[model samples]
Target: IHWHMNISNQINYVAADEKRQIIPYIHVKDMQGRVTEYFAKDSPLTPDQIAKAPRHRMDCVDCHNRPTHIYVPPDLAVDQSLLARRLDATLPFLKQQAVTALTGKYETGDEAMQGIAKTISEFYESKYPEIGKTKQLEIRNAVDELQRIYRSTTFPEMKLDWKTHPNNIGHFYFNGCFRCHDGQHVSPEGKVVRKDCDICHTVLGQQEGAVSMASISGTTFQHPVDLGDLSAVNCSDCHTGGTGP
Candidate 1:
């Protein structure tokens, strides 16, 4: 299957009487010529008629921008390792120290790998010498795992990290859905593509466990931080992956 869009120069020709620009919709197709297309709510074609006149043809990578080569962020890697018991959380400050070690600046991938090993080994050996002595093998295994994580997720030669390539599955970290769903796309008739969040997802109760079905059904998300209202916000506007706190 393919997912593509129409981005011809003509699409950018500015129309008067609008504060925002309009762009074409995303299109999808399979090898057998079967096609599925997504359009702004304001699209002229009705639902029954859109497939015959898709705006573009698309492939796997249009949304899955990175397929094989994925760089996991240092924080996420540490969290996953701790969850999987690959890195012991009983060790004080392991998560914080691991992230710091991985994200440290280095001249090359080899240098980064060596530095990761050295930094982590030195940290445990110096600060918690008794634990280091008793759990030498476990400590060594952790160093190896962290080194592996860093080597796999980072390419200092290319200066690539999570920020360079975006995962389009969610709105956070990058402008995934907002690339088209910002509600700016409008038809000549002045109708707009709805940017309602519920169109994509409904909030199940967050941060609470063992809730009843009634609690999960109608509860809306409450942003931990007060951002006034979310109508004007896109998650990518603030969540810049590793670049952010």
Candidate 2:
């Protein structure tokens, strides 16, 4: 028998002083037609209550919620531009500067455009005057790209951005797969919603600078910055869709 489930929404009923909680639940039927229900380890709902509670079958929209309108985060957007050579990697601290410019506070789209221009231009001109003069074209291109990124990802009118909506594809910037597979959800039989990295996808290869590693089977997932055991927290706890933790 096979079963797949995820908690899409939760009832919000917490006092300001109380800590918020979620009680994810799942029901599965075996090949023999026997049905079993499982709730998170600390779920307060009884079997009768769980049976009566509304349930939604897993669907594409549940995972692919932002399929059409994806508000790309500044850091991810900058990394992508660098990878594509849209923003010249040879420019010193281009990624850092671009992300900094993009994440700056701005009230309107026009302000964002002006802010991006000023931030990138001022940064290069002040820090490395020679490079700023010689690499004017590259710097301009990077500024334009960063502004474009800002226009697409940020919307001050709607108060919407990458951080506003949690992308359900990966667990890096948002709680994605870790929403259920956080190891906190457990069944009565003691079966956990496995938080193992390899459970869903395999890391075929990893590359950093000039160093590259690959394997046909899979490679162990490594954190870019060592923060000790990541099992205790979600990636979204640190990565807030901006620059850094």
Give the number of the best model, judged by lDDT.
2
- Which lDDT tens digits does candidate 2 get at residues 159-218? 887777667777888776676678877666787777877887699999877988788999
lDDT of each: 0.64, 0.74
Q: How high is each candidate's TM-score?
A: 0.63, 0.80
Error of 1 at 180 (Å): 1.7
The list of candidate 1 runs beyond 4 A from truth reads 1-61, 125-134, 183-196, 208-216, 231-233
Residue-wise lDDT of candidate 1 within 18-130, one digit each (tens)?
A: 21123245433435554433456554445455444434333344466667777776778878888999997777778767877888899898898788788878888899998
The residue pairs in collision within model 1 are: 2-58, 2-59, 3-58, 3-59, 4-58
In candidate 2, position 67 carries an lDDT of 77
Q: What is the lDDT, from 0 to 100, of the residue 116 in candidate 1?
A: 79
